[model samples]
Target: MPGPKSNLIDLEILDGMPDGIALVRVDGSIIHMNAALRHMCGVPDEPGEPLKLESLAVPDNIAQWRRFFTHAAEDGGPMSFDATISRASDKFTFYAEVSFHRKSLHGEPVIVATIRNMSRHRKIEEALRLEESRLEALLRLNQMTGEPINRICDFALEEAVRLTGSRIGYLAFYDEEQEKLTMHAWSAQGVKECRISNRTIEYPIKNTGLWGEAVRQRRPVITNDYNAPSPYKKGLPPGHVRLERHMNVPIMDDGRIVVVAGVGNKPEPYDIRDVRELVLLMEGMWRLLQRKQSEDQLKMSLAEKEVLLKEIHHRVKNNLQIVSSLISLQSEVATPENMTAAFKESQDRIRSMAMIHERLYRARDLAKVDFGEYLRNLTSYLKSSYQPRTAEVQIDVQNIMLDIDRAIPCGLIVNELVSNAFKYAFPDGRRGTLEISMRKDENGILLVVADDGPGLPPGIDVSNTPTLGLQLVHALVGQLDGELALHREKGARFEIRFK
Candidate 1:
């Protein structure tokens, strides 16, 4: 007796409704019910034209429901509550969502109540929560893999004992070459703190014990019932009666077997998959430790090389000083003018080599020398070279260090420059002041050698000077890969920028 469109609307509403429905009067008398309510009440019959609300079977918390209904009937209008209900089969429990609403039906005040079964949904929620917990635990294991092996092994032993609800666990480190597995750590507080003075153990790896099998096969081995006939029975120590289960996993370092992490006295056997996962984590931690050890060894080797180089420089300095003393002694006994001049030249050569070693001794790096110190020493030697009894030479140096390759050529250039100043710049009883100064600027090394004597001979151009000293200076500057500027302001200023 319904039209097609009206029937379609009724079907849609019925399918969309979430829970059971019931109609009751203000006084709590049952009037009508829906299919969902019939299933929940576990009765198919209407029971004498709609049973009384209190007469119909309900949950033990029905008094709380009535109180909620009365409260909804007041000015607030509607209320909701949750409770657990038992099914008629007596095998299943359901979470019930109940709602009460005060409304008018057939122009009479009534209360609309609804209930929904939530047992299946609750199961799904619990499963999701458990999966999330497992994922978090796996993440913690991965983070532990980044630490050192000793720490990782310690954490693994603690986790294994805790997971199995056991009171004792120990880890044995396998010495592959020596065929030994020594107990390194134990869960018992007193045992771990005990000093292990006796380090060697006669652990035979070729035997059928759990530690030997794990190391030889590169896998994990478990003994669930150690009390029964077991391959590892002989490996147990004397008076060791409490161990009921055991598991051993191999730890690898750089793809090579390193240690066997054997756990004993477990409450029960661990799964094969769990043993494999823990071994894999231990392998990763061992790899990190191996890399750190290699890097430390490399740094130590480099430090030793530096020490050897410094010692070589120190020996060279001592040898050159002995050569300089020989040259000075030879020059003191020479009488002929030519012999004295030859001996003096020999002394100069030895002094040059001595300067190199002297600078090397004070340098932090043996491969280079301080350029400022070299220049000052060379100028002082040249001032003495002329045997000038009146004029005094002064040196103004700046801070700079040059590699040995550059220092040698630059030192020779300073020697020639100072020699020219003492020889020709001052002649005929004329006293002069020679200033040798150097500075480092953004451009490069700024070296100046000037004198307060008569300027270069009137007919000599600095660019085309025919002097041997000038020629040597030009060649040395070229070797430095630098440029030279000639200034005729006070005396002769040869300014160079050598990078």
Candidate 2:
């Protein structure tokens, strides 16, 4: 029921719209069309000419358009559908979205439709979704640090095949040390002839094929038609599956090709996007492999160094034992009492040092020694050295570990103090007991060497004593950064504390 003015305004608005507009009679015959629609249909805007929907639609879509018009008339509501329109050139088709509405214009029943091309928009949306998937795959690859290389390659191949719609794919790693390429993992879906059963495959030394071309070029290569004749063409071997289309991506490390990933037999031609995605995943996996290799080399070097250090300790202990034997021979020839005592003391000191190396050779950690075990052995040796003596030696030391710098000084101090007690504390061969105890407390380590014998003489100060043994003890205590005290209560007692 629109007036003349209103109808004119509606026609003007329809002609100016970006989308194509057309009006058809209920019988499916075109009554009027805007300039956009006339351009889409590729016909002149004649006033009285016969134009039908069937003439504009592609032959395959003619039936679909008939069904759509029937449904729109029956439903009498706004309806939308997708269809292809034949272009005037007849060389290409246009994908479009068409919306239909039943309207009454100038007392005539007609179908109004607006058509918009959707091909470009569809491509844009698909690209966006593809980019999102690529980013997610990259993130998953980054989180796979410390995983085995085979597992990483398997994951990468699976994603590549899925994204590229490929029938089969594989990842191969190059060993620079060995100068060869080994296939680590492969993925095959719905491919019966090319199914891979082996865990790994070693390429021939003189590799000649599409894969070799990628390595030689040091870049990505895509072949839409593998069967085409060319100089780079190398046919598949016997029992090998056929390849229709293929893409190869090489991963580089320090200007050398370290890995190559390839996909084959896609339903369509492979494009740049496929190459980009595969390269991204392969590059990440290559970095992880490099890091793992470096770590393995470092561990091997450390093991070699440890073996060398243990051998050095063993030889040093043997050399010290030889020195101790020389001192014993010299003491046997000495007739003077003072000379014999001096030789004996020197022998004991050398043996004490030799014991430290012996313990180190036996220990799992070469840097520290079990001081308690060392003291036990030292006390036994001292008792044997003072043969025919009636004094009994007792040890009550805790199991503590000390480094070489502290253990050597501590061992010498114990030797000097205990030897003095056995020699002078009990005169006339009187029976007595020498006690040695060492413990660690919050303050520091405490060492006590005491004897149940005649105590030191009155007014005798150990700090100022002129005896070599006492002076040596004072000097060792100072080197340890410790405090020393002498207690004369029915026995001689010396205590020292240090960290």
Candidate 3:
């Protein structure tokens, strides 16, 4: 609407402006458009019929735009505002800030408008906001401990679906060796939208199609166009939620896939960003599950150790009482030699019980002890206790192991019998040999302590014997539900057998 003489000058000035520029009437018809403004609104290059400014606007934004023009026409002042603009027939759309001033050209009221696109700035802000949300979700997941794995997996899947703009999702545990899947979780929205009840909870790798491609190929699978025909496309289950677009990623540990997670029905096409989000969430979830399993195992082991400790404390208390009784008995002995001997016997008995606990504390497997190793240590101690003896102690024991209950009594019985050998069988420093042998015999054990010296007195009823050593051996053998027999051969041979 500029004069003909100044039209070229005004046109040149408008074209030189960086911001989009347009001249319009209050009725919404365009008077003029600069090249920048024409491109912003998706205008055609060729000149044609006069264009209406309303035609270039989004349909839903027309009402606000009309109001903006009305205010500009009446106020006769510069005005500014922000809104969304789009060409309805195309995919062109952007957030824009519009500044305008009412003017008069050739005595007709006109409006000069300038547009500054803000779409890129808004997108960057939204991306940062989403990234913050993802970090916060990961922090919460890492804090989860001792929770049921299904609950943790479900939480992770829900976040994956929400953060990726998907409406449905599932998490399945994969067994690489078996090439199978165990359905672990389904998002809450997925369950509600899916009308299929008692859905298939497992599937073999070979039987799966598109979604399983992520697992088969060991990478992410994205289907931006769900209806695109392909051999991998399979029919959905009856009453299952419909899908327009889908994405999934495989979670890998070492070189094998450990989990498969799938999401579907995103509003926009799935992209690499969605794949990255799902991968991070699923990996963190796997770590949380592993930590929970380890915590459960540690709790169970602590419980078992507590029970074992109680049993050990009980055994130690009983042994201490027996030691007290032995000291009392030694005090009643009338001879110094007999008292010294009684004291030595008591020291060996205490050491026997102490040795069992010491070995248990150091053992890899706390439930059983190496009986042969225990006997060897015991014999070495006894030989050192009975000094100045030339008798050779020959031992033949197998690699038999026994639990603490059996080991304690069996060790005490061996102590009493072997001590008796060094004391009575080898008098006058008898230059002979004492033999000890133990072996497993058909669901029972055989223990023998023989000395090549004078044998036990004839008609000695071990069951009614008044000697403390024989009495203790009888009691301990009875505790094991075993029997003791004395064979008078080249020496006194005591054989004890028990299951």
TM-score winner: 3
Give the TM-score of each candidate: 0.36, 0.53, 0.67
| Residue-by-residue lDDT tens digits, candidate 3, 322-411 | 678766765665377676666777788889888987887787667789999999999989889876377898889997889888998899
Query: What's the CA error at residue 88 for candidate 3, in Å?
Result: 6.4
Candidate 2, overall lDDT? 0.78
Q: Give candidate 3's TM-score.
A: 0.67
What order do candidates take by TM-score, descending? 3, 2, 1
- Highest lDDT: give the candidate number: 3
Candidate 2 stretches greater than 4 Å from native? 1-16, 29-68, 81-95, 175-179, 195-200, 204-206, 291-499
Runs in model 3 with CA error above 4 Å? Answer: 1-6, 105-107, 146-148, 254-256, 296-308, 318-499
RMSD, each candidate, Å?
21.3, 18.4, 7.4
Residue-wise C-alpha lDDT for candidate 2, range 1-499, written one tens digit per residue: 1223236677778888888887777788776677787677566766355677656678988888888888776777978888888765443677888877888877776788777877788778778987788778777876776677777777778888887878888888777667678877768552357643543378753565766778777789998998887687666665566778889888888888788899988997899888887888778677766777787667776785587677776756755664566466445556676896777888788788889878976876667899999999998888788762878888999999997768877988899888888788778988989999999999999999999888878877878975666776787789799999988886999999999
Candidate 1 is scored at a TM of 0.36
Global CA lDDT computed for model 3? 0.83
Could you tell me which 10 consecutive residues in candidate 2 have the lowest summed lDDT?
Answer: 1-10
Residue 190 lDDT (model 3): 84
Q: List the residue pairs that clash in candidate 3.
A: none
Instruction: Give the count of colliding residue pairs in each prediction.
Output: 0, 0, 0
Model 1 gets an lDDT of 0.65
Q: Could you give me the TM-score of model 2 versus the true structure?
A: 0.53
